[model samples]
Target: MIEELQDVPAGVVGTRVSGRVTADDFRDFKPAMDRMLDAGEVRIIEVIGPDYEGFGPGGLLADVKQGFSTLTHMRAFKRTAVVTDKEWIGHTLHALAWMIPGEVALFGMDELDAAKQWAAG
Candidate 1:
């Protein structure tokens, strides 16, 4: 399941994810993202819990497609911060950080407040 991480600033959007995320997760999130984009708020910060069991195959595909399909829209973001307590996830973010056009950072859940601070700045 997923829910918006409220209390963030107007320019930033945040979410938390847990369990086996399905295409429904993407479908549910797309409109939020689209609305944010339309509103000229591009930054995003996602807190992914360790309980996240990974995405369904189709969900994974949809995520990849969205990256490409919304490449321009996605690139409008100045940064994407992924906060997690999982080491491997942090490592993955570190690995891809340079590849993504915008800055990407990973922080442990223990440092989530710091992460949000950085993302919001």
Candidate 2:
């Protein structure tokens, strides 16, 4: 499931993901992002909990579609902060960071506050 983080400052969009992620979740997620993007450039903070069980096949496809859509308007995102305890996820973000237009930072679960601060900036 995906839930929007409600306490973030203006210009920053945040989401918390747990359990199994599905295309349906993106259905909810995409609109929030679109709304934020429509306004102007925004920063993102994603908090992936330990219960996250990866994405379903449909979610993967949805991700591809959403990814392309986001890339098409890549400049809309100023920065992305990911908070997770998983090593693999952090490594993956680190590797992908070099290819992305904006900055991407990974933080351990304990550093969620710091991640939010960074993304808010």
Candidate 3:
């Protein structure tokens, strides 16, 4: 699930994705993400740690829908730092980084602080 994280740097929206992410997770988390998007600029820190079990089908669909529906909002993405130990996630994000309008970086789970610093920058 996408559980919000606190104590992050200013202007950074931090979240942790763990366990089986279901539709309910997004239902509860979308508002914060929407608010970030509405602000017209986004510096996001996504920490997908060892506990992450991938997203449920519904959650995946919701994510895809939200992303595709706001293609223009890609420009609002200032920086995205993904902190994870998952190899697949790192590969996927690396492959898709070019599609994002801003910097997209991958960090080891232990480097969350560094990720936050990069995102906030």
Residue-by-residue lDDT tens digits, candidate 2, 1-121: 8899998877788899988889999887888978877877879899999989999658889887888887767777788999999888988887888876577888899998898889888
* lDDT at residue 60 of model 1 (Cα atoms): 88
| Model 3 error, position 61 (Å) | 0.5
| Tens-digit lDDT track of model 3 for 1-121 | 7889997998899999989988888889989988898889999999998988988869889887777866878788899999998999988998888877788899998898899999999
**Winner by lDDT:** 3
> In what order do the candidates fall by TM-score, top score first?
3, 2, 1
- Mark the regions of model 2 whose C-alpha exceeds 4 Å error after superposition: none
What's the TM-score of each model vs. the native? Answer: 0.89, 0.93, 0.93
Question: Lowest summed-lDDT stretch of 10 residues in model 3?
Answer: 63-72
Could you tell me which 10 consecutive residues in candidate 1 have the lowest summed lDDT?
66-75
The TM-score obtained by model 1 is: 0.89
Native-referenced Cα lDDT, model 1: 0.79
TM-score of 2: 0.93
lDDT tens digits, residues 14-86, model 1? 9999988777888888888787778654777888998998887578887787677667675577878888888
RMSD of 3: 1.2
